[model samples]
Target chain A: MRPVLIMVGREFRDGLRNRRVVGTTLLMAALSLTLALLGSAPTGTVGTSALSVTVVSLSSLTIFLVPLIALLISYDAIAGEVDRGTMLLLLSYPVTRWQILTGKFIGHVCILTLATILGYGAAGVAVSFANGVAEQGAAASFAVMIGSSVLLGAAFIALGYVVSVLVLDPRTAGGIAIGLWLFFVVLYDMALLGLLIADQGKNITTGVLSVMLLANPADIYRLLNLTGFSNISTLSGMAGLSAQVMLSGTALVGALVAWIVVPLSAAGLIFARRQM
Target chain B: MTSPSVRLVGVSKHYGTLHAVAGLDLELHQAERVALVGHNGAGKSTLIKLMLGVIRPTEGHVEVLGVDPAHHAFAAVRMSMGFLPENVVFPPSMTGAEVLSFYARLKRQPVSRNRALLERVGIAAAASRPVRTYSKGMRQRLGLAQALIGEPRVLLLDEPTTGLDPASRQSFYEIVAEFGQKGTTVLLSSHVLAEIEHQADRVVMLDHGRKVADGTLSDLRRLSGFPTCIRIGLPSGVRFHPELPAGMAECRDLDERTMEIRCSDASKLDVLRYLLDAAVPLADIEIAPPSLDDIYVDILRRMAAE
Candidate 1:
């Protein structure tokens, strides 16, 4: 445990010196501010207001941006060290391989979480100010959005670790990480929609669809923040599908938690089995 | 006598079909500096890694500081061990001090000592600067400082002085010598046989995953069976080559006033006495013994012949 903590401290220092923490924080903040400014234009209406509308836009932005950012930061966690010729030296220390992996995981997750909270928090404050005081229960739903978005970022962080450990080279791991981002963010929804259309409402049951959507961490994140509350689901545009899917709030959160743990465990195992 | 710092008993490691290290047995005592010389694929690096417990051997046993390398308790051994790999790159964004502190923390050493280590390795001024701004030799010095953390009892250095200039290399050896005097068992691998010939207390020659030779410099010279040459220079304008020794070989004149005689290891003094007894109008006599390079080549030749 001491070794792990030492490694975590080192990794965190490395992140700060590299300016990854600051750069990512700034980027998340800027994008979220833009989404909030544009997303809050329809507040004070009969339908949705600042908090719920911001949640909708922020969730959409997260699907595109959070995983991409997480992958960008974490895809080289192991492979990059090996390429730069530091892995062997680091391994020569008394610490075990699992400690190094866990340390790096903790450090990178800290960076991403910092970026998520501060970035989204700034936008949340800005949106609340623009709407002339937030409504009742809206602040609670907004908190849930920020929290679930962090989970989304963590799930992708673990997935990036899987890519980093399994791939032999940093360049290959980087390419595969981008491919993963495209598959999950852009191509996955299109492919699922295609599968639904081709089914012609015959073979693709609602149960199958729910399972399929839950398989993607981004979708699970969306379900967690966008569906449970009324104002969020109405503006999130997932009310019809949410009614059909039929999942409690706990089950959706559990699925996202599994996404973070399972891939992280696999990465640790692969790193342990590896030669370097 | 103190127990060996490192001991390998019939140890071998194979990666799939390729034998990285064949069945081998070797031991390194405390304060003993051994140079591991070999070709590119001769298993020197693998052997170092095996002793460091970075990789487990497939067959037989490896005992480093009295603990099997594969054991969980070997971390205690590692605390007293330092390693500088052939290519060691510190994280670029970290300051030199930060890098040393990072390694110091991981090594479980007192962080306050890191500043002195940086000063010891002559990188103190650059301690506050990021490592990316460092040159190759400076980076290597930083690597040495990290390895010196906790003053490891057993140091495994693979081509450590590769990028160091001559002066830096000399200081590096001085530091290593200081550590050696304090009872650090140092094993460094290098392809340049001449550089470490005088530095190492003993030399171990490896050939294609096998230990072909291991001994002190004089022991190796005696074992290699290479002849030592005695060159005698006659006085100016005196060209009489008068060497009447039957057993001595290659007694011939090279220039107007010089004669050379080659003799076996056992008969070097005998030939010298015969030349002196003959009173061969000599100017000066020089005896050239077999060098470590010659013994190493001879050992490799013998290994290949088998």
Candidate 2:
């Protein structure tokens, strides 16, 4: 346990030294602020304030942005080390394989957490202050958005590890990570929309829709953020999703947690059996 | 008797159909420096990995400090062991100090002690620079520093002197020799026999994944039965090659002033006495046994013939 923590500290420092933490955090924050300022429109009467509108836009932004950031940062975790021959040197020390894996996982998670929270949080605060809306419920909604976005990032980081340990070549791992981003973030939902459009209501039931939504982490993040709050749902225009598929907040969080745990455990098994 | 620092019994490693290591049996006693001499693909690295427990043997047992290396319990034993791989690398973003301290912390050693350890390897001047800026020899010395961390009882180095300059190699041997004096077991692998000839106490030669020869220098010279050369100088004005001595196999003019003679071990004395009886005025006389490299080549040839 001591070694594991020490490795985590080392990895954290490495992440900082390489500017992984600072780079990702700044990118996410800049994009979040851009979306927040432009996301709101001036209507005669406001159904919800600028804060909920920002939530709507930022949630959409996270789906495209967070997983890409997570995947980019973690896709080379194992394979890059092996290619550079550093993994051989690192292993020659008295450290265990699992410790190395867990430490990197934690370090990447910390980077993603910092990126999602501060990136979204600072932008969210600026928008609310400009809009002059300070209700407690809006704050809670903002917190949920930031928290679920981090979980989404963790899910992709875990998926990245699976690719990392399974592939021997770093370029192959990079190709796989990009492929995963396209499938989950862009193509899966687009395919689901196409299916729903073709079914025209009779065949594709809401329960089936719920299960399908559960399969993609981005959809889970969408479901958790857009529907969990009424003001957010009204502003994001995903209010229709809540009408058909019903899931408790706990279920949404559980699904995202599963996305993180299952793939990471698979990586652990593969890494343990590997010779290097 | 105290347990040998490293031991192997009938160990073999087969990669697909290629046998990396055939049945090999060896034991390295504590504080004894052994050089593993073999050509590429001759299982020198595989044998080192087996002793380190990174790869399990297909046929037999590998033990370190009396504990089975293949078992999970060897992790504790590994804390006391060190390894310097043939081609080592560190994270390019890390400075030399950062890299050594990273390994030091992992070994449960005091990170502050790395300053001196880095200096010991002759890399202290560049300790604060990123590893990417280092020269090849500097990186190799840094590798030595990391392997020497925690004062491990068993040290396994593979081609440790490959990229070192002469002066750095000199310091490297001196450092490991001091460790050897303090009861640390050092097993270094290399094909250049002369580099380790004077440093290693015993030489273990491998051919086709098996131990073809293992012994001290004198022991191997006697066992191989390779004839020793006795070169007697021609006295001034004596230009023709001298007459043959009893038990001398062949005599030939080696140079302008010397004749070279070869004799079996049992007849070297008789050959010397015959030269004396012949009233052969000699400028210089020297007996030369087979070099380690020659013995290595001879052993491999003998194994192939058998």
Candidate 3:
């Protein structure tokens, strides 16, 4: 346990010093803050709190950006270290493979958490100040959005670690991570939408659609932050889909957690069995 | 023997049909410094990996500090073992001190000592500089410092001196020698036999994934049975051309005043007696025993012949 904590500390410090991490943090803050300011522009007439409007816009932005940021930061976690020969020296330490993976996972998740909070928190705060005062319900949904964004990022980070551990080549892992990002965040939703339109409710029922949405961590994230709350759902224009989908917010968050755990565990198992 | 700090019994590691390391046995007692020598693909690195538990052997057992390295509990033992791989690399963005401290934390050693370690490796000046700015030699020295983090009970260095200059190499050996005196079991692999021949207390030669020879230098010297060269320098004006021992020895004239004779250890006394009997004035006689390189090449040749 002590070794694992030490590893976590090292990995966290490494992430903090990393140029990519710093750049992504700044990018995340700038984009989310811009979205906040721009998103609250029309909220003056909508009568909803500025924070709730920001939540709707930020949830939409997170669906596209958070996973990309997470994958980009974590795609080379294992594969790059292995290629650089640092993995060999690391494995020679007293720490176990699972400990290394755990440390990296916790550390990367911490980075994503910091980025999501600071990046999106600044936006939330800015919108609150701009709109005088935010409603209690809107602030609650906004907080949930931030928490769920971190979950969404964590799920993708774990998936990226899986790719990193299995491939043992940073370039290949990076490519695969991008492909994963596209598949989950963009192509999967597009394909599902295409399938739904083609099926025309003849075969694809709401229940099946709900299951399909739950299959993707990004969709689950979208479902949670966009559709979980009635007020935010109405503002985000997901009220109809929210009513159609029978899944609960708890279930969506559970699926996202599962996404994180399963891939991270798989990475640990494969890493343990992998030769240095 | 203090219960052999490292022991391998009939260990084998195979990758597909290629035997990276065939069934072999080796042992290193406490405080012994053994050099592992072989050509590329000779399993020197594989053996190190097996001992380090980075890769499990396909067969047999490997025990380091009385712990089976392949088992989970070896992590505890691993804290007491240090390794420097063939092409050691550190994170380019990390400073030298950061690298040492990171490894020190991993080994559960006090990070405060890392400054001294960097100083010992002569990289104290670059301690705060990122590894990318370091020369190849400086990085190698940092790798050595990382390996020495906790003053491991067992040290394994694979081609540790590759990028080091002569002075660094000398200091590297000096540091390793200091560790050896304190009861650290050291196993280092190298392609340059002459460089480590004097530093290692014993030599283990491998070929085709199997150990061909393992013994002290003199033991291998005797086992190889290669000739020892005896150079005799006569008085500056003496013209002596003797040595017709017929198959017992071979003689060659080096210059006008020097002659060289090669004979097995068994026939060395006979050749000297014959020279004395011939009343050849021997001014200065120098006996050159077979170096580790000669014995290594001879052993490999003999193995190939077999």
Q: By lDDT, who's the top model here?
A: 3
lDDT of 2 by residue, A129-248 (tens): 787864457788888988989899999999999999999579999999999999999999999999989989988887899999999999999999999998788767788878778999
Q: Candidate 3 falls in which docking quality class?
A: medium
**In angstroms, how far off is A93's CA in candidate 2?**
3.0
What candidate 1 gets wrong by more than 4 Å, as runs, is: A42-47, B229-244, B251-261, B271-287
Off by over 4 Å in 3: B230-240, B252-261, B265-288
Error of 3 at B123 (Å): 2.6
Tell me how far the alpha carbon of residue A98 in candidate 2 is from the true structure, in angstroms, after superposition. Answer: 1.5
Say which prediction, candidate 2 or candidate 3, comes out ahead on DockQ: 3
Which residue pairs overlap in candidate 1's backbone? none
Each candidate's TM vs. the true structure? 0.94, 0.92, 0.93
User: lDDT at A228 for candidate 2?
Assistant: 91
List of clashing residue pairs for candidate 2: none
Between candidates 2 and 3, name the one with more favorable lDDT. Answer: 3
How many clashing pairs per prediction, in order?
Answer: 0, 0, 0
Ranking by TM-score: 1, 3, 2
Better of 1 and 2 by lDDT: 1
Better of 1 and 3 by TM-score: 1
Residue A186 lDDT in candidate 3: 85
Per-residue lDDT of model 1, residues B1-306, tens digit only: 999999999989999999999999999999999999987889999999898888889898999899997889988888889999888898888899988888888888999999899999999999999899999989989988989999999999999988789899889888888898899999999888878878899999888788888899888888988889888888888866554556667677788777788888889887777777887677898888877777788877876787
Q: Interface RMSD computed for candidate 3 is what? A: 1.3
DockQ of 2: 0.56
lDDT of 3 by residue, A1-276 (tens): 877788778778877776656777788889989988887887767668888888888898999999998898888999998998888888889888899889888888888888888888889888878788777688889889999999999999999999999899999999999999999988998999899999988999888998899899988988898888777888878899989998887888889999999999998899988877
